[model samples]
Target chain A: MIRILLPAHLRTLARIDGELLLAIEGEATQGSLLSAIEGRYPQLLGTIRDQITLQRRPFLRFFACERDLSHEASDTPLPGPVVAGEEPFIILGAIAGG
Target chain B: MSKVRVLVGTRKGAFILNSDGKRQQWDVSGPHFGGWEIYHMKGSPVDPNRIYASQSSGWFGQLIQRSDDGGKTWEPVGNKFAYAGVPGTHQWYDGTPHPWEFKRVWHLEPSLHDPDTVYAGVEDAAIFRTTDGGKAWEEMPGLRGHGSGPHWQPGAGGMCLHTILLDPSDPQRIFIAISAAGAFRTDDGGATWKPINRGLHSQYIPDPNAEVGHCVHHIAMNPARPGVLFMQKHWDVMRSDNAGDSWQEVSGNLPTDFGFAIDIHSHEPDTVYVVPIKSDSEHYPLEGKLRVFRSRTGGNEWEPLTKGLPQQNCYVNVLRDAMAVDSLDDCGVYFGTTGGQVYASADGGDSWNAIVHDLPAVLSVEVQTLP
Candidate 1:
């Protein structure tokens, strides 16, 4: 199980004000995490991915165990700490401009 | 030689990047503002020694600080503009103050026309002008004259005024971009504003003018041709030939074709630059790749100029105000990536070199002629 903490906006969209829970069935990577999250919360499909490319949106950031999961592959294995459920993965909406 | 310094603002602090124009010759200093995020900043153009920075922490409210004596020390700027008054102003606050949505100032431009005049685009979706420089700011009521229905405001980021293009030749003819509200101009010294968003693709719909969908992230204009403007809209790149009254798409041929910051050559009207991000997915271009393109012929076509950039998959998010053009004839084009690397092209984007690297996530980059 990969516990995911969402930022304020995503939390509202997912209708979950707190950390979300998702079963990690296959490989753990940015792509997998997003697909899983969107699969669970269908409304958030186009919100994160472009529907066509499945690429993360601009100003959107991903983190797992304090690591920026934005640049990492979706297939990258979950950190041992995350695999252990010590610290949950986090998806953040990066604040830009002034 | 005068030292080259770049200010890199981040959540940790406002950092300083010092370089000697060489490889990895970079020195990053300071969590300058302590823990508060310094998003928008400007080293005083009139007095290069003084620096002005605006900070906000969601609920902590907004505050602008000024540093005299070359950033060695700093102090709060205005009393009315602060949650707590500093010295002259009487306003005070007992707890953290949350800034009004779209209330934080994003960019500060000291008036080249009047040394005492300064203008700032705040998050509250208004443009504030300060006659006494960074002292007190009043919302330019003229902006409200532009039509904005409920559908005109963007979903998020607020349909606020973020770009302020002050005509150096005729200060009265000012151009500003208010995200989803569209591009506007005040030819009579900001007394009235008119929409200039024609031909700009509205991002929310198939139509180009989608009431509140065409977000103009930033706009730049040629100082010589005050009427011409280049704007980076939420959907595409455009140019206004008639002083921002109407626009035409100019992003002819560029990879992915999505980005925030677009810069025009300081001296050349036809030559300009844009940093293209991946449009299919906005996650910092494709595979965290970085590329800054050059359009030597006014965006009719473009060529990728990434000879000396990074080779690894890296997200290079360059803010709207982060890319710059130095005034040298060969025209040095410089930009700082969100990955904290500053790349400079001494020969106009033909070949590049990393002037500095590893600075706290850079927010903005501005270069000036040092005496």
Candidate 2:
């Protein structure tokens, strides 16, 4: 089991509208973890990652174990803590300015 | 870091808009240099204490203003920063001398490498630079149009430069994109300019390759990787790998690549952000929906962020200078629309809040982390 935290904006989209928990059936990886999360929250499928390429959206950032994981490859395994269900996978929409 | 105030230049005048952390309230001030049409305003990123303003009149020529004490008060910086020639140096219209008395310094950019140097793209259809902190300036001769006889008119946005991005790593290299004219690059500090629009298609000519006049509205470069850039062209979005030396059309998956500005993630050189809209029409999002598109791995992929956003008809056009990102660990993306709404995403983009509604047309929104 893995916990997933959505930005305030995504919370409104999932209709789950709150903290979400996802159960997976594979080795921990951005792709597999995302698949399980999206499988449960179907409406969020194309919003987070491209449905076709499974790529994170342009303005979105991913974090794991308190680190920026958005730019890391999708195939990268979720941190061991997340795999062990001790930590949650965090997906944030990146905000930018000068 | 201190409270970063947003400098907005508009038709009314220059305005200093301040925001409380979450954008709960925005304090708008000025018409600072009233009576002049202020086109470009900037607060130096390296030195928040200094600010620059660009203004022009169809009859009075061009002027720039500086504020040392923020925007609480402003003073005209004088001919030192103004672009002008004696009365009859160039052809005149409407009985006034000087080439079409400067309409606007369409774009003003501060060099990332040397904050002392300031660049302004103006209406005389030329680019001007100031080295001694706007205390006197010189023109980059190459920015002048080679084939542009007095007869060739400035296109949609005027013979103006709307965007200029400086390379932080290499001070000598720079990219300048002018509307109606092709893009150009100078690797040796404007000593010479080389046309860098090889792959950028021009809509003016029948044979795309042969066209010379391509309109580029705005262009952005990653501070991390100077050469990696994106441009919102007339009909498409082009990514340039060798600075502006060459470009590749990457709007394959976009609902529409027609946009005013292109911004990249502050930390990630490959990530890009854009507000897409159909080209021919008044540039509204496809399906009447307002969405900000993202390409995480350098245009290789794109996805929309509609979470916590309006699901109904969205008729707001966001100017390139208006959208911004907080980039906090969880990063915050905020952008204001012509509809007078400011929307923010606290979780890098996962969720959003309509922080402020029904404000004046928000010309720009820049956030600064205060110590």
Candidate 3:
């Protein structure tokens, strides 16, 4: 089981309260988790990643176990704490104050 | 009681302002979809309860929100706006071959008689229509496929199809305006189109009278007189009496003809209004005084209407889609400024009042006259 934490706007869009628990087939990777989440909630199709280019939006960042994982490859395995559901993988919108 | 609902889209969010026919007091609703750019929001003419909004952001891409209860509660509709077929290419900034891409929707023009049907004008200069109340969108590629695709260039705002006007008398006819692409008309109802810029002369282009590079800012039409059209081009104020077949300059006796928005009085077809900026490069009012010019004689002569607007050290700009009209017994003219002010003129641009003084920088303003 993998627990994912979406940003506030996405949480309102998907209408989910807390962390989302998903069942992954193999290793808990970012690509597989995103695909699973998009399958579960189709409304979030291109909000996190580009629909055609499949690139992460510049203003979004990914983190897990208090470590920045946005620079890592999508197929890389997530930390053990995230895979074990002890900690939540977070997708945050980078903040730049006006 | 005749009520007025003004749907305002801003850089930060969307706001709904409700008022009675008197237009004295207003009940402001929100900054719904907060922290996102609300490009445009419009209500259905057939069904006043239905409203559609173009919401987007750098982080979340694009989203279309539909409100069935007239700006009360909104639900995200289908945001997938895929261009039909190969989608070809147009001239980029450097005159290079640039492929068409869907960045965001700039306008939402609901059908005049059908709430389920609406047209979306998007950046990259394409028009998409949805018959299922924005649940899905299909591109009407005839506009871009009108044989002038490769020559169309982007303006300072990127090539955006920002205006859509449906002829009320002739349901088969429609008009669309794009930045740096002039104006186009479709007589066969979205199957085929042709450029209708005959007398438009822009000094910026190499050929001052080119057919498809005028950079038309906004166009307006009166339902009673569909043959007569008013346009605010990049530099001059123009008019087309023969339904956009040919245009003539009517920018007589104004402080400066360079402006963004244009509209006609709801009751009078000859009564037109435009906000005059100082120049194309300096996008502020002349001499730090904001005024709206009204042309009662259909074009040659003009008069400044400035009753309650700021007249001292004010330098805000009115965008292309930021002005709109409400068709009540007394015609109401409304416009929003880039400095975050929405002003309303109840007595047909004779006097003005700020409905909301400070919001975000407003992108578009639309009003629904409800019975």
Best-matching candidate per TM-score: 3
Report fnat for all candidates as fractions from 0 to 1. 0.00, 0.00, 0.54
Residue pairs whose backbone atoms clash in candidate 3: none
TM-score against native, each model: 0.70, 0.68, 0.96
TM-score of chain A of each: 0.87, 0.87, 0.94
- In model 2, the Cα lDDT at residue B21 comes to 54
Tell how far residue B353 is off in model 1, in angstroms.
3.1
lDDT of 2 by residue, A1-96 (tens): 788888764565355665687777867788998888777765455557665445576767788788988788877878888887788788875665
Q: Candidate 1 docking: what grade?
A: incorrect
Tens-digit lDDT track for model 3 on A1-98?
88899998888788899888898888788888888898898878789987666777778999989899988888998888988989999999998566
Expressed as tens digits, the lDDT of each residue in B283-311 for candidate 2 is: 56767787888888788478888887786
Best by DockQ: 3
- What TM-score does candidate 1 reach? 0.70
lDDT of 2 at B59: 27
- Quick one: best lDDT, which candidate? 3
Give the least accurate 10-residue stretch of model 1 chain B, judged by summed lDDT. B83-92
**Candidate 1: which stretches are off by over 4 Å?**
A1-98, B1-3, B18-28, B79-102, B149-151, B203-207, B210-213
- Better lDDT candidate (1, 2): 1
Question: Which residue ranges in model 2 land beyond 4 Å of their true spot?
Answer: A1-98, B19-36, B56-61, B79-101, B113-115, B145-153, B354-356, B359-371
* Candidate 1 residue pairs in backbone clash: A29-A74, A29-A75, A30-A74, A31-A74, B102-B123, B102-B124, B103-B123, B103-B124, B288-B314
For candidate 1, the TM-score of chain A alone relative to the native chain A? 0.87
